[model samples]
Target chain A: MADRGKALALPVTLLLVFEIWARSAHLHSDSLAPPSAVLAALWSAFADGAILTATRDTLMSAFAGLFLGGSIGLALGILLGLLQPVDRLMEVTIEAIRPIPSIALLPIALIALGFGYRMEIAIVSFACIWPVLILARAAVREIEPRLMEVARALKLSPADRVRKIVIPAALPRIFVAFRLAAGIALIVAVTVEIAINPIGLGAAIMAAQQGLQADLMLAYLIWIGLIGFGLNAGLNLMQGRLFGRAALVRDRT
Target chain B: MTRPVIYWRIVSFVVAAAFVGLWQLIANLKLVSPVFLPGPDRAWASLVRGFTAGDLASKLLGTLEHMVYGWFLASVAGIALGALIGSSRTARSYVAPSLEFLRPLPVSAIIPVAIAMFGLTQTMALFVISFGAIWPMLLATIHGFAAVEPRLYEVARSLQMSRLAVIFKIALPSAAPDILAGMRLSLTVALILSVVCEILAGLDGLGHSVLLSARAFRSADLFAGVILLGVIGYLTSLMMSFAEARLLGYRRGVL
Candidate 1:
């Protein structure tokens, strides 16, 4: 309770101060909006369902990109982790490509995919792929040698071995990787929207900015922050529930 | 073993060569519009021509300047604030919650806010970049300082070390690894945010160049801009790694 109070104290105080100042000064700047006005803006954005539609568009593209990129990364990571010859052959190529900021490909994606969900997803997925691939490859490679020995001794086929052993062992780490990728997916998706694509929360914020609706823009900004916070908290909870102490313990080690 | 390793090296070369070969073939065959999928030769030529004749050099320098300035500002502020909060348990208790609440904010969301505040200027980009890039370093610094061994504090107490001296001498050294790691992440964040801001604001940077080229349907120039950005990313990261190794060299064998 005390901790909660401590946490709320700073933000609440700041908000109150701003509210008083804005009200007293009758600030008319396009950028400055009172807390009350922002709240009203938020309530209206929600009431009319504009924010809802924007949220849906953003989440849809983010999830689609995450799913597409995560699967590819997982498959490729497992292949590279399991196959020494292939890993060796691909190492140079991977290293060479890895440092390129995914945002730099925004133009290429724009050129090929045009403006819409496809363009946004293409960029997000490109951003999302690296973390999952790097972490998943590491996770797979770090699996206990005894597990592989057991699989071999049982004469499990490669497919079954991977399905039954490799995945289960590496899953917790892979999930962590997914969490990381999911964050990137949202970030890249918003970035794509803010840059050019005319869909999603980012676009909403931009629209609000262009319209000089500072209150609405601030409302959208707060909403995006809330969405990011909620996504991270929800994923962290899921990770804790699914993997429990095992993942937590290993992570610290 | 050596033979297979050599063979793998040979295979790696072939694979890379094949990729370029395939791209060239596709371009030659006009599988995709040259406007959309320019050949590697064209991209390379464009890159060379850009540095030699175009304003690409200036754009590159602009981006580097923006990224470095933002990163430097973030580092200074992050370290100062992090130290202030990290040194006091009460301060951490009060501040950490707010920091946690703020940290998960999608950094790009602030771009619009900055634009509203600064009206699409270089100052807006600087503000957004610094704001976005500060979190990692701030958190890392706090963690590093807070996690310092109690025994060190005891020793410092025995030595009658001043508060500032203790922080500067003991805490800072112990926190170097985490702080360095944070700075590295912050640098990358700064670079990405700088690019995003430049693209949105139509600033004089590689990002703006790429956006303009793409809009003009100059695929070769667009590709060249992207390659230059990638090269910058690669070189900066390489430099960071070298710096990390140098600073953390003593801890290498110990770890």
Candidate 2:
């Protein structure tokens, strides 16, 4: 933990330098805010509890979308993984769809579903699905041939094989996908809000920017970072609990 | 491929065609509001019209230029800083907190910050894209270089190779796999951030055109714009994989 302090020292020093520079330089512009002022802005915003509300709104869309997209991805991945024909038939389409950044769909989604929760959640879901689908498919395809032989010898039905063999083997990758998706979902949700939906932390950030509240905008940015950190940390903890630390490791090789 | 697999591949094409046909049918029949869901024909016409008017081409060029520049800057910075931090544990220890604090922040959260600094200009889009693209590559490079086998280092040292020689000949080759993966991810992020900043900055780009089309009730044009972005995204991704394949030919292909 003391080493952690060493880790933070550099950043703290940089911020302090920035604070001194901003004040000494007397840059009374909207472009720059001293670290102290930014902190004060963060404190005031937190005191009013507005940041929490905006945070809840953002998390709601992200989680709701994550659930919808994650499940669809899992189901599709399983289907394709177990059935060679299905995999062959869908590979091209999936590949083509995979590259489309969900953020770009904001305009179309806004037109189709209108502003607010529906449109925001839909775009978020689209963004979340791709990583999950790609990872899940790879996981399934990597199942050991020996495991399949054993299942075959045991005369296990396809459903049983999938349930007992495929899912367990793929759980680690799926969880990784969930992590990636969660991050993407949060980003997309916030983007939708900032760009078109006009609700949540993103909307708050935009409002602050337009109001020319540089300090307040910096504060909102901090809160957004905290929320993202919390989500990632929570997921990491859950994955470790469910699947062991090995599963949470970024690179197996 | 076997006969059934070949048949399945053909089936994929058929399925795609069928979906488009169904979309056209519903669109023309007014089963859904055209304002919400423009017909494929309308979308196609919009594509042609935008190109003929040179509106879409210019926007695309603007977007591509911004993304390419931002992505290039990100690659250079990410790899350079990554190599620095990865080169030593002491460097990593000092830098870890900064990287941690910055990496967790969602890219959207930084849009406002970029706006405050750059304010609705092409630079704002570039700044945000570069910022967003850097982290993944940075993290991966650090991990890759740090994870280089200790024995490899020992051998290089025993052979009296210079620091630069060790890094180039030994450390880099082993780190290539992870660095390549990071590059792919960063490219995708660069593309996404470019579009996003275009929208937020209300700048001249495909994203801006899409937003404009929606606001003006140009549904067909909006769809066309989205499809154009999608096509661009797909081709870039394809290009990345092709490059990855050639770079990692020893492994036959990228993961």
Point to the candidate with the largest TM-score.
1
TM-score, one value per model: 0.97, 0.92
lDDT of 1 by residue, A70-122 (tens): 88889989999888778888876776677778888988998899989998888
Q: Each candidate: fraction of true contacts kept? A: 0.73, 0.73
Candidate 2 residue spans exceeding 4 A from truth: A23-27, A142-169, A245-253, B1-7, B251-255
Which residue segments of model 1 deviate by more than 4 Å?
A: A249-253, B1-14, B253-255
Task: Give the candidate number with the greatest lDDT.
Answer: 1
| Candidate 1 clashes between residue pairs 3 or more apart in a chain or in different chains | none
How does residue B248 of candidate 1 score in lDDT? 91
Chain B TM-score in each of the candidates: 0.94, 0.94
lDDT of each: 0.90, 0.84
Evaluated against the true structure, the overall lDDT of model 1 is: 0.90
Interface RMSD of each: 1.5, 1.5
